[model samples]
Target chain A: MKKFLAITLVLALVVLGVAAKVKPIKLGAVLPLGDITGRQAANAMKLAVKEINAAGGVLGRPLELIIVDDEMNPSKGAAAIDKLATIDKVDFFIGGMSSGVHLAQIPILKKYQKITVWIGAASHLCEKALAGADWYFHLHPWDYQQGAGYAIGWKQILEKYPQVKFDRVFLAYEEGAFGTASYKAYLAMLEQAKQGEGPYVGLVKEFKGESFKSAAFGGGDYRAVLRLAKEWNPDAFIWAGYDADALPMMAQAKEIGFAPPIFIGAPPGWPADFGKSPLSEGVVLYGMWAPSLNKVSPVAEHFYNAYVKEFGEEPATYFAPLGYTNVYFLVEGIKKAGTLEKEALIKALEQVEYESPLGETLKIAPSAVIKHQGFTTQKILQWQNGKQEVIWPFEVQTAEFIYPFPKWEGR
Target chain B: MKKLGMLIILAVVALGFLFPLYAGPYPLHVMTTVLTYMALGLSWDMMLRTGQLSFGTAGFFGLGSYAALLTTLYLGLNPLASIFVGGVFAAIVAFALGYAILRLREIYFAITTLALAGVFTVVARNLHDFTGGPEGKILPSAIFNGDPTKVYWLTFSVALGSILVSELFQRTRIRFAITAIRNDEITAKSSGIDIFKYLLFVFVITSAIQGVVGGAYAQQYGFVSPESAFSTNFLLLPIAMCLAGGIYSTLGPVIGSVILGVLSEYLKLRFPYGHLIIYGVIIVAIVLFMPHGILGMLKKIAQKTRTEVGGNENEK
Candidate 1:
């Protein structure tokens, strides 16, 4: 009789344990794994998943991330979404990079209506496409938001240092989607500034933009544009192009003696070792997060260290931290919801506030089109002594601002 | 043997038509992509049958995409009607462009056609108010509201149409004319064939087919951008597929599209991090080892086996 009772009790315990085990919550990510941004972002997501699983997982269920490479093609990106939604049946959709690819994916994503948290695609057109998608959360700023952020950053910098002035601005944009969009946004802002309404009202008095064929597109000679900039002699000179044009553009500008009071290169990503180049110094640019932020924020430090330790390389792009935050933010929402119910999870997500490694508190807000926008402001940073140091956002300042850009003669 | 080949072709078409019944959205999406590329490859092969290495597939494709999207946006035309509009627009453009470009042959023609995409992209980029400029245009919704089965069937019809057109080219007097032209253009002209007219006709037809496919793709995806619409992948991938499957035939590109398409998806899944390098290497290997393509190699083997059998009978 005693042996029989013990066996029954053990069996019951085993049954309960088996019943308690739950299937993992799957996340489907479509990214261009060929690019540095996508590769690092994918790796960072894996790290976050590992960390979350180790911390007892979300809602007592482990997270499973299924990543597909988009190959940087729009059709491939859309097809990847179909695969994830139909074949994998992922509970959520995440990961994005290019706006064009994301634009193609929007229809497919709309079909599934899955809760999507994307970390890239800054184009305002994407925001417009995703206008009514309450389930979609965008972590990257829209182009207009980035433009506004820069206007504000410049405004603040001018206030901080009255000695510095940026009354005239010249934009040398590449003749592509990214550069053209940037030029258009700047033009809009400039018009607003002239009317004394937008963020740049008190900062920029005159703005001129000219298009150049980007070196990335096989047109490298910037002598014409550089000569134009030199003749205009603007207070601030900025070029919106690709990383391929960085060194060559700088060389041409140097050759033509086109130094301005403030020079900014607003490429998506800089070439490796660009900071080591002397030309990179005193060049103000825009970005979401930098390794220098690791010094100021403990969250940034943790992410940077763990990323380096796990991947055996430093996080090269801001997308890495953004990817990590993407997973954690969703997981936190899942934990709050206590289930994968769509409505409940969205509510939980909207209420959740994450101290992101990007040195900002990420919260859900409204943009011009979308309901959920994150990280609206980008930090203004300058390359100083082989390091990107934040100069704006005085609360997270990593270094002092350099006064006029250095002359070409003295190195 | 010919009846058996015909039956096999009919069976394949039947299966393709019925594929959406058993397949899920993912496979359907992949097949839609395959069919799009198959149509493109067939059109390219059709042009190649004329012995002109045309590189304007992407240009016409972009032109069709823009036409379809713009008509839908501005003219408020039905999306289905817009696809035909795309084809008609491409045909008219090709007819006009063909008159000047067909005069050149070989590398000069190829290079000029290759530049067509660049020229169109610049024009598209500059036309801000009409075309949305570099930002491009997007439809309010995808065709059929993003129904996978419907999209698959639409693309299947286009591909089937392409196959029929290719067969028509093969069976009709157009075949002899194109063959003679490919063999010796001067001889073909002297043999009472209007070489220029034939070339222009083939070019316009193929460009129309490309335009239709591109229109279908844009409508299915519900957007058109200068970069995406005029992407070189439209030109290069079809060429690669045609080369790998055996050029200048209807069956070759079909076989190539299936094999390469499925292999590419499989490789991407199996090796996400290093798939492209592996895929490129495999393509290079296939091109290097099988210069005549898989179909050509198979034909050669069959011919050799038959010859051996005849020799054995003679010995007996």
Candidate 2:
């Protein structure tokens, strides 16, 4: 009995010593893991951590990713972030895919003063994060850049076709920060082009004052708005919102004859899966980066290929690039910082100017207003035969533009 | 027997008060959420006593969130004081609403309250200018400068107060009155028990306490939206905890909340996608195996042991 006890004790001590050998750098991701977008983000983060660990990890310590489900809801996000910061004592944060979730997480982030990288776009999230602390590092391109880019693409299209003038442009956006900001920026772009010194003039005939409609974020049954939009007889209609509204908008718009000549949406509203629907044909959208373009960079190619190998499928969302790169930005920041200290990490993140997977030098603005929102230069794409094809930034254009949306004929 | 129970209560509270001293931020936050469930379970149990099935915890919770948030924002009151005001505001609304809805019988009452909660969500969504619309309002400052220790104590105090109130009610003559109403409303009415009056009184008090819980929620997390405030989890989780803990008793709710709360956190960790599924399974299991809850089963065992021991002594 004494001999057996001695052997067991020796074995226990060996196990404990071996366990102590590994010092892990804990990282937390707050995402709606149940939802496809969040699940993709979580998978991408896990893949990145695995790769980093295989590459001898960060500062000789293995990177540990702690993922918490936010349920794509604000309260749950705040609670999850609280758990990440307070309970787990995470070294960093790479999360907030939904603007609602990000907005909820802002206060907790400020309280913890942890270095966080953004994966969600609602420019207001940046504004809120910046207002609270200097530790927030946003990677997602803001609504202004994407909205203006879409407007410029529309301008180029209009300038190319002389007779195709957008006499009336109607804007219907969800009342959340992303939609609201993008709508305003697009409106400002129309006004700017009209007022600017350009050979690209006479594209916008008139900007109606009351054309902007702000839909409640969670309101269902959009048939009333469809009726109003059809009656207005708009040459161009802009639908700015998230996927929830966007999915129904496609079905409901086709249900009524509300198809305008020119239709464009902001990033997430144009989900890759939406192309599966026949109603998705001819809908133009803008994004920070698309793997479909593939010409973004070699880093983009590598990330896409790795995701396919790890997950056994193509990433069907634009958020994968943003989610995958957000972790790398944090890892790069940690490398630059050299130490795990909060102040050092914050300073290093602020100074980060790494070439991202999207082939752009990811960096933050100096001010709180647009801090870390420098991932501009979005691509304009249109859906053709259930496949989204890049049609703008002429250098990256894989396909030509399809002008004047055709009406639903005998569908 | 009373002294022993009181001593145990005191001991548990003393441990709870010392929780932050040893715990880190995450455990403290989780415990704070547990306290929230405790208060929710206890408050729901209070209403359940009077044969009233109200599915309007979300309605009152949402109303309290807006009330507290608006009070702090516009009135510029302190968070604690704002929470008090919010609770009172919810109680007032409940009083008025109970005048109409508490007269409902069985499923009608439950359905009405559920519909009322939905109505609160819609009203909060549409009233954008006031309640910050659907996006929710992040308070300019948190209660106690976002101190986890302080937040834990505050939530603990509220939950403790609710549990004591529940125990006190169980001890009082109001218990028999409510029990009579629950057992048979027609018989109780024949015997001069004012059914609506008793129901309204219990509903108002339970709702007032629940409102305080909502106010604490707004102050703690520092934000509340229509969706956040009116999440069905608020309604369902408490009911599940109460039923699983053994309904209509203080001991039942206390045990129920702790087990369900810890189980939920564990399941969330174990299977993030299926936590809701796990929660449903737990409720079903509790209903099937232990219809009377863990406390009821324990009570039965304890009684049996006492009877057998007494019989042994008699035999000797």
- Top model number, DockQ: 1
Tens digit per residue, CA lDDT, model 1, A197-307: 888877888888999999999989999988998899999999999999999998888888888989999999989889888988899889989999988999999999999
* Model 2 Cα lDDT, one tens digit per residue, A22-130: 7799988888877777888788888888999999998878999999988775556777887887778888888667765676567667778777777874555336535
Each candidate structure's TM-score, on Cα atoms with residue i matched to residue i, is 0.98, 0.87
**CA lDDT of every candidate:** 0.92, 0.77
Local lDDT at B131 for model 2: 78
Best by TM-score: 1
Local accuracy of candidate 2 as per-residue lDDT tens digits, B1-316: 9999879978988999999999877677778887887888898899888887888887887788778878898788899998887789889999999999988989999899889877887688667668766566777667786787898999999899898889888999889889999999999999998888889888888888888989998887676777678888788888888888899999898898889878877788889878878778878999799999989999999999999999999999
Candidate 2 regions exceeding 4 Å error are A1-24, A59-61, A72-79, A82-88, A121-126, A129-132, A142-153, A156-167, A172-222, A240-252, A265-273, A337-345, A367-370, A374-379, A392-395, B307-316
True contacts kept of each: 0.78, 0.34
**Candidate 1 C-alpha error for residue A43, in Å:** 0.7
Cα deviation in Å at residue B261, candidate 1? 1.1
- Measured with DockQ on alpha carbons, how good is candidate 1? 0.84
lDDT per residue, candidate 1, B177-284, as tens digits? Answer: 999999999999999999999999999999999999989998998889999999999998888888888887988898889888888899999999999899889888
TM-score of chain B of each: 0.98, 0.96
